[model samples]
Target: MRPETGMSATGFPALVLFDLDGTLLDSAPDFVATIDVLRAQRGEAPIAADQLRPHVSRGARAMLAAAFPRLDQAAREALVPPFLAIYREQLARHGAPFEGVEALLAAIEGSGSRWGIVTNKPEALARALLPLLGWQARCAVLVGGDTLALRKPDPLPLLHAAQALGVAPGDCAYVGDDERDIIAARAAGMPSVVALWGYRPEHDDPATWQGDALVASAHALIDPAAWPRPR
Candidate 1:
């Protein structure tokens, strides 16, 4: 199951599934912009840029909650659609692949391997961001949160992506920054890699999560020579 020399994953991941927002792309700039819009609408003071960056990978609802924790439950629900709408307009406006991600995907593709996305973001937004990043045609598959009745941590979407890519669960690997990402991949019977570079709350510890491997940096994942091998 070893990948050929140039692939990102050392073992040929029959399908390499990635979590979009934090695993590959740095999406905080645009996410922060949307937060600013929400803040303005609520007549609230703006949040610090540094304060919001770490939560970008967590998703829109999380960012909203962080910015407006004082809002009641009904008000929180009311703010969601508008927050999402604002984010939609700016999905890829300032996003960029984290360092080495483009090269990693290139190495995988160059080695005749396939890669795709399995994200908790809704389908429409995920689809829209793909073209902006020029990955719409290059990616082998995309399974968003609402693509099916369930999302990550449930395993259905990951299973669907593997199926679509003609890969078996045993041969695939999922990479993400959060604990749920690890849980979803494991539940789907695939190995998981904890991406340490992604957003985490101050108190969170990615190492304690159950992942087959822990990638401390994006460049580390791109380097096949440094990968974990069988004992």
Candidate 2:
């Protein structure tokens, strides 16, 4: 193994798992476009990207809540199918890796360490996005919200990913932009990193998340030295 490159001796914990939407990709644009599609039908102007940026990590339901505040819970719930349909069509149109993410990923791979995605996004959507992101062959494992009965904040998904990768939970590190990510990682007995440059808004303070480490930008992780070490 490449000790200088930081490859694990057992090739377990060989992966760095990440959250898809906010942690790796800048998906707020797609969410904004999707919301604008809904708003336009009612002759409403497009919502600002920032207006929906912070809600991206929470998935469709949260997007619906932010996009249609005037509508009550039931009305918002009813809009999910249509919202997902539009989002699927506009999936990667306005989304791309966050600045420096590509290089960061490359660095990880080049170091003989692999990476994967475990997201709250549906399995199909996450699977579809891999090809678009040119990561289909490179991603070591993918566990989506629907991959198992439970997702983040539950720890099942994270634990399941480690098992699939043949890595002990404590040997893996999870990076995410949501509190659920940290909670899940902590529960799974893995290290965690908070992506500060992700969809966090003024109200969402990542400080309290208590991840193993926190980064102000994806660029900060281009060097493996900046990555959080497994406990």
Candidate 3:
């Protein structure tokens, strides 16, 4: 069955939250480029972007694994810092908001609702990336993976974001691309939407994530009617 569509029992959501990497930002290009740079340093040919795209949501380590399949777990873990360092240098050089994101943000603002980000990305990186997109001042709240002792799939980050926005969890809806995003929203007592356009491995399935709704693209989010309603 389709999830309920509007405000929850608490009220219409005062704030809408998004996950950074795969959901709001199309950051895979920059991520893949960074991995290619690493490969070049080792005299290895660059891997295809599509090969590493799905692992972007899973983080740097995953992308590294995809790029260097022969590396042992310890060797892969060792590349995380270098990967992030290179990524930081080229964070938004190729990154851009997903199609229709600007209009969606404008619609949210015009409707008198606040919007923010809750991402598993490190706080420093998240902070650094926002300004590159000129969203540093516009976002109402931002909760990074390091913002608290807990992260997505644990619910604390989502709950913390709602509290910081001065809105009840029931009055917020989170949009993300990962299963952990839905699990966290559910545990926080908030509704969630899965962004189908975001990163997903061939074996991954959004349908089984149990989000309140599934949106095909950012453009769909511009319409208030497309949001998940209260059950």
lDDT (tens digit, per residue) of candidate 3 on 21-140:
999999998997899899999899988989999999988778988999999999989988999899999899998999989888888877778889999999999999888899988999
Worst window of 10 by summed lDDT in candidate 1: 1-10
Query: TM-score for each prediction?
Result: 0.91, 0.93, 0.94
- The candidate 3 region of ten consecutive residues with least summed lDDT is 1-10
lDDT at position 96, candidate 3: 97
Give the per-residue lDDT digits (tens) of candidate 1, residues 1-231: 333222234454556789998888888888888888889877878788788877777777678778888887778788889989998998878878888899888877775678999999999998999888999889999999999999878899998987776667776778899899999988888878898888889888887897889988878876654333321
lDDT of each: 0.81, 0.85, 0.87
**Candidate 1 Cα outliers beyond 4 Å, as residue runs:** 1-11, 225-231
Candidate whose lDDT is highest: 3
Task: Report clashes for each candidate as comma-separated counts.
Answer: 0, 0, 3
Among residues 3 or more apart in sequence or in different chains, the pairs in candidate 3 whose N, CA or C atoms overlap within 3 Å are: 4-229, 5-229, 6-229
Q: Would you list the clashing residue pairs of candidate 1?
A: none
Candidate 2 residues lying further than 4 Å off, grouped into runs, are 1-13
**Per-residue lDDT of model 2, residues 51-164, tens digit only:** 898899999999889989999999999999999888899878998999999988887787677789999999998898888889999899999999998988889998888787
Model 3 spans > 4 angstroms off: 1-12
For residue 220, model 1's alpha carbon misses the true position, in angstroms, by 1.1
